[model samples]
Target: MSLRLHTLVHACAVVLAAGCLGATLWNGIAERGIALAFGVLVAVGELTRHNGPRVRQTAPLAAAGALAYALLGEAGGRPTHHDAAQIVTVVLAGSLLGSVPHVGRGPGPARDHLARRTLTVGFVAVCFQPLYARGTFDDWGGSAHALLLLALLSLSTLCDAVLAAALAHSRTGWPFPPVLRDELRALPGIGAAVVATGAVMALGVAVVGLWALPLLSVPLLLAQLSYRRYAAVRATYRQTITSLARATEIAGCTPAGHARRVAELSQSVGRDLGLTEPELTVLEYAALMHDIGQLSLVDPVPVGATAALPVPEQRRIALLGGAVVRQTGVDPRVAGIVERQADPHREQPLAARIVRVVNAYDEKSRTGGPGGPLTALEELRLGAGEYAPQVVESLARVLSRETRERDGLTRPGAG
Candidate 1:
């Protein structure tokens, strides 16, 4: 069904529950409102977090809000087998809707995490009615029901955590299930299904008290499940991207050590420029991956050719590099910057300029003997247009200080 149709059905269910349940609806509405409000708050917080730990702190709040709402209501509703059945329907409907957006998507670490989280949340929302049903009974069955509910909830959450971890792995590239992906894409409908199921549970409880709670829990749980899962998946995807970047640093003859000098120089420049942590992460990844396209260079040119390709050959090389980056399917502009690492003066942004300058320093430094390093004037002249003048000057000052401290600038043309 269309989103509008699902929404309308959900609205009708809420209205019916309110009319049928009276006082129960009054209490549950306020409680559900609080839960939803908390969900919104946590989502906003997760969006702004600077790190994983901060983002993770929001999930517990969502769980706490759910528990609080469930705990506020009293016991003694009717037998809610119908409520239990309705919850399963709502969960299945919601899962179908939530997975819709992901349909036909292929294997990817990011997509896998997203699918896993959605499935876990779907399971949790669907099992809500059973949990509440267990809550309503006063006997030993009630205890067993609560235990089962707890186990299901734990399993759902565990699945999400596992997916998050898996998505962060460098080697992972699991295909997302087409059916499940489509369900995730249609989450608004899935959310509506939860609401509808909640209304039914609320209605059952109004007629019978605590008995309807199992039904009520379904909607409450469904509303926030997707949001949390999305957050976790996003974190996982970032880690995977970082791993890919680091892999690029290690792809060539020098191993990942080739990027070490670039990173060090860039960090020095970053401190000089007062970059933030997020900016530094971006710089580090870009620097590490700057030479990635070189790995795809076929019939490998001699080492110095990076600086002296004929015009036609240069264009051909750049095109080859661009193609290799496109194969990874990351952002093209980012790929373009990496491809142009050997040509820093191509009107890049400041960070790209810094990266290119440091890259040049590392390439040149590798050629220099370990003994006394090149003279300041010699190094500056060698590195002039290829690196920023200020960066060259900074290296000059550092070298000058080191030479003075270690050897009293005794060498000819040194101080």
Candidate 2:
């Protein structure tokens, strides 16, 4: 199903792009100067785009330029004549041309990104160009024009977000609602800037002509640069946390890669349980350092199997981990989760409950084991009275899917 859906997404984009290119060839070109200007703006945007892991919108400037072109009605008080097909063609050309240099140097836009970009621009152009060409928006002058552009861009932005989430879900088999929730959560940030800049560029072009393109683009460029810096800072912070999490292993208090395995499994379960993005982050950080407290232990629990230790010892280690987390200036919630992972399920927050269950599962399956994964899971289930029943179930489901995926019993992108 995901395979077909994934193909359908790309197929739709290919069809739209083909139609636009064919139409443009038949219709020749209109307002070549304007098209070239916006095309260059888009290409420049792509060249300067941020490629950070956490970046939601990588090419904000390209998006704004294309959207502005879609909503364009007049330039320098003269009615511009470019249509939907021309708008899509120009943007597509710009995207391809801009990606050329990045071919061997770095990662270019993926198939999904291009598909999303093409479809989004096509959507905006289809809605606006025909309406303006028909003179339906003739009376929409001044504030009416600005408001209409804003409304159109807002709707287009929402559609792009939905498409992005849908494509991601199809390609990765992640649950849709959580992915959609994250996209919607980003709407107020770079999404807003994209919409506002697109609309403002359209308005600016109408009054001040094509010269408005470069001048109106300054704010978004600055915002993009600032966001890149922020992404760098965030990446550095996460690296620092990861290095810290490895301390137990470095000191031989825990098995090599134990923290990483637990963190990965915990995050997978957290997503399966429908934790939001920020909640998942806290869960991951807490899971990675869940064993940091073992560094404080006088003697490491054999194989770092804190899960087999007495409750008091586990609690002591958890408290010590929390203290260490606090001293590192991490998020307070992360510290809290680390601190409370040893508490009873009902008394603990969901993140803490997740860490506790997944940690035990990893320890059991890896070392304190006989039947391996199945045996470890059985043990965790029997002790669900201590672990949250819901979290344990989520862990089981995540592990089951992972097992099938690993064994190739399930198809790629099958959840």
- Scored by lDDT, the top model is 2
Per-residue alpha-carbon lDDT of candidate 2 for residues 1-415, written as tens digits (9 for 90 to 100): 2445768989999999999999999999999999999999999998887775557899999999999999999999899999999999999999999888888697778888889889998998999989899999988777898889999999998998899888877755568899899999999999999999999999899899998999999999999989888888888899999999999999889889988999998988888877778888888889988889888888778888888888888899999999999999999999999889778899999999999998888888886456778888888889967888898888888877777567664566555
Off by more than 4 A, model 1: 1-239, 242-254, 260-264, 274-281, 301-319, 344-346, 371-382, 391-415
RMSD of each: 18.8, 2.4
Sequence-dependent TM-score of model 2: 0.94
lDDT tens string, model 1, 239-333? Answer: 66556655544544234465666665675565445454455556665665565555666556554234344535544554555566667765665
TM-score, candidate number 1: 0.36
How does each model score on lDDT? 0.45, 0.89
Q: For candidate 2, what's the RMSD?
A: 2.4
Off by over 4 Å in 2: 1-3, 368-371, 403-415
